[model samples]
Target: MASTRIGRHVKAPRATVYRLLLDADAVARWQVPTGMTSQVHEFDPREGGAFRISLTYDEPTDTGKTTAQTDTFHGRFVRLVPDAQVVEVVEFETDDPAVTGEMTITIDLADADGGTRISAVHDGLPDGVSLEDNELGWRISLGKLAALAETGELP
Candidate 1:
């Protein structure tokens, strides 16, 4: 299975970053990649809990492997370590065989240099997804996370 690992250092406390990670509203604000909007239909931040998120491209005509104009996914919280780490198993709602599979995502947080250091690892990527595109999307989302966590604003 393919994997993508990336990290970012945010100008916010570990607890704050961790809290934002689990907050459904915060996720709705920043979890999507740039040029996209997100809606969280369900979020339960606990072990074995389930959440569903839908990300829609800004342009209505944009279509994805999952569906027209939007990509929706559902996942279960595999683990949650307060202010430290979070692991989840995500499955894309798609009909394309190339993009069918479960993706395991783990986010690790640490206190460092008066801020929070975030490490994100995604495993079991679909064969159709490009590594660079995935990383770019994560980088954008992480930047948004940092902005929100640091200044209580979205960029």
Candidate 2:
């Protein structure tokens, strides 16, 4: 299986970063792109806990009808270490032909000079997937997380 890893250093405490990662409400606030909204169908934030995120991408329609494309993500938490690490297995459920895979994502945080060094590793990608695109997406998402933790604002 293919694996992609990305890391970012955030100017926030490890505890704060961990909380932001596990907080379902806070996750919906910062995990998605600007203008896109996410709803948590279920979130437990503990080992063996179930989690799901339904994201709706809204686009303006020229025909005056609001259009939205909805995608649902189902996953379970494999491990949870408060203020240190979280590991989850995520599956993408979509009819799109281009995307199909189960991803195991691990987020690690370490205390570094009054800040937190966050590392995200995504594994179990299917063949034919572009690592660059996956890495870029993770980078952007993590950057958004950092911004949220630092500024107390969602991205």
Q: Pick the candidate with the highest TM-score.
A: 1
lDDT of each: 0.92, 0.79
Q: Quick one: RMSD of model 1?
A: 0.9
TM values, all candidates: 0.97, 0.83
> What is candidate 1's lDDT per residue for 43-83, written digit by digit as tens?
99999999999999998877776778888999999999999
77-150, model 2: which lDDT tens digit per residue? Answer: 99998899999999777654445667899999998877999988999875645788668757767888998889
Q: Give the TM-score of candidate 1.
A: 0.97
Residue 115 displacement (Å), model 2: 0.1
Taking all chains together, the TM-score of candidate 2 against the true structure is 0.83
lDDT of 2 at 144: 88
How many clashing residue pairs, candidate 2? 0
State the lDDT at 4 in candidate 2: 91
The candidate scoring highest on lDDT is 1
- Give me the overall lDDT of model 1: 0.92
